[model samples]
Target: MTNVERFLNQVRQSSLGMKRLVVVAPHDEATLLAVEHARKELSIDAVLVGEEEKIVAAAELAGVCLMPYDVVATYGDSAAADCAVRLIAEGKGQVLMKGLIDTSILLKALLKKEYDLRTGRLLSHVALLLPPQGHGYYLLTDAGMNISPSLYDKQQIIENAVDIAHALGNDNPNVALLCAKEKAYDKMPATLDAVELQALNLAGDITGCTVSGPLQLDLAVSAQAAMMKGCKDPVAGNVDIFVAPTIEVGNVFGKALKYMGGYVYAGVVVGAKIPVVLVSRADSEQEKLLSIAMACVCTTSIPMEAGRMMPEMESA
Candidate 1:
């Protein structure tokens, strides 16, 4: 089986037992179709929060029957977001999905103090990509959030991505901090940060992964390239996570892989009370379904503290 298929199968076999997925403003056909697929294929219960009339229309457009799902009526996008977040806070759902609502609206409601969803960690986006011909998955992080992450922010980003890697069954993933060169130069800040991050990982400050850095893109992913460059880090040729220096690099890298390399991806926003399935409207239904499954798996594995979800980095 392909790595994506195996990942999906693992999620299906997990003992999560019918997680409830709350979708905000699911007034679009893509969202409705994805939720329907998740409900049928993954055995997930879906709660759709939006205008009932619009949801019914979307269901019809998508050829999805809503008889088996719960539909919560709301007047507008803001109301839908608020209602969905409130449901999750009340433990009515285990996953939050972004649908037709503006991301800003959904995130605003999610960050409200009343919901108590914040764990004081930065929220970062992680995309799990299946290469066209590769045998495993690659995680690309901070693509949709944290535009210009400082060194500390990058550390949290890596920790968040490591949490995802663990959910994917990789207990100790190989992480490569992407840079333009294999050696840190005085003028290149990213390369310098990469060196520092590698040192932190070696010092037992960053846990659960083998970190390597100051590697160019080719060296990070291609064993042949690493060999040609005389690089010796084990992570050089077998990276499970690629940490981008900036959001622009990550965004362009992910889009290139999806648009040009024929890679399928499942994306989620981590460091929240629960995993958030956040995908573009243009993404295929398969992508959305995989994203929901990924979130479900994360909900079961992410650690909790004092009755609240706490990221491993925070508790570290």
Candidate 2:
């Protein structure tokens, strides 16, 4: 089985129990079908938030039996998003999913001060990718959020991605801060940030992961390339988290892996009170289901203060 399938199977066997998943603006056939699969296969209870008529129509179109689910009636996309976020804030749901609505609309509701979902950290997107030839998973961060993050924002982004890795059972993940060249140049800001982040990790300011950086893409994932380049960093070839310097780089790289390399992936928004499943509309039903399962695993396994420090890594 692929790493994603293995992870999904692990989630199913985890016995996390039936957690409620609130989908904002679930008025599309793909969304309905995915939730149906989640309900049946993952044992996840889905609360559909949107116009009742459109939801029912989409369910009918997708041949999904929505009779087992609770449907909340909302007039517009904003209303639906607000209602869904409200449900999550009120403890009625453990996970929030984006469905059919524009991501900005849903995220606006999620970030509202009245909802109280913010955790004093920047919210970033983390994509779990199964390489075409690998037996393990790789996480690419900030692809769908944080267009241009500062150095401090990147730190939080790393922490958020590390938490997801921890949730997936990797206690100490290797993080590679991706840059154009392996050497820090005055003209390149990303390489400088990478050097600083590496220092922070070595000094224990960034905990629970080993950070290596100013590494090109090839060296980050290929031991052969690192060896040929005389690179000696342990994380050079065995990275679990690939931190992109920008959203454009992350997005293009992730899409290339998906479209050209045939890698399967599931994307989620972390660094919040709860994990958010934010799959694209074009994402397949299986991808959406996997995203939900991923969120389920993260919701149950990761603590609110996850990535702050791993118990074993703490110096007593």
lDDT of 1 by residue, 1-316 (tens): 7766777788888765769999998888888888888888898898999999999999999999999989999998899999999999999999999888777778778877788887646778888888877577899987777777889888988998898899778999999999887889979899999999999999999999999998888988889998988888989889999999988899889889999989997788877768888767777877888888889988866554322222222100
Clashing residue pairs for model 2: none
Q: At residue 250, give the lDDT of candidate 1.
A: 90
| Regions of model 1 farther than 4 Å from truth | 304-316
Query: Worst 10-residue stretch by lDDT in candidate 1?
Result: 307-316
- State the number of backbone clashes in model 1: 0
lDDT of each: 0.84, 0.83
Candidate 2, residues 1-316: lDDT per residue as tens digits? 8666777788888665869999988888878888888898888898999999999899989998888999999999999999999999899999998888877777778778777777766778888887667588899997777776789889988998998888878899999999999888989999999999999999998999999998898998889999999999999889999999988888888888888888887888877788888776677777788788888887865445322210111000
lDDT of 1 at 40: 83
Model 2 lDDT, full chain set: 0.83
* Lowest-sum lDDT 10-residue window in model 2: 307-316
On the 0 to 100 scale, the lDDT of residue 310 in model 2 is 9
**Model 2 misplaced regions, further than 4 Å:** 301-316
Question: Among these predicted structures, which one has the highest lDDT?
Answer: 1
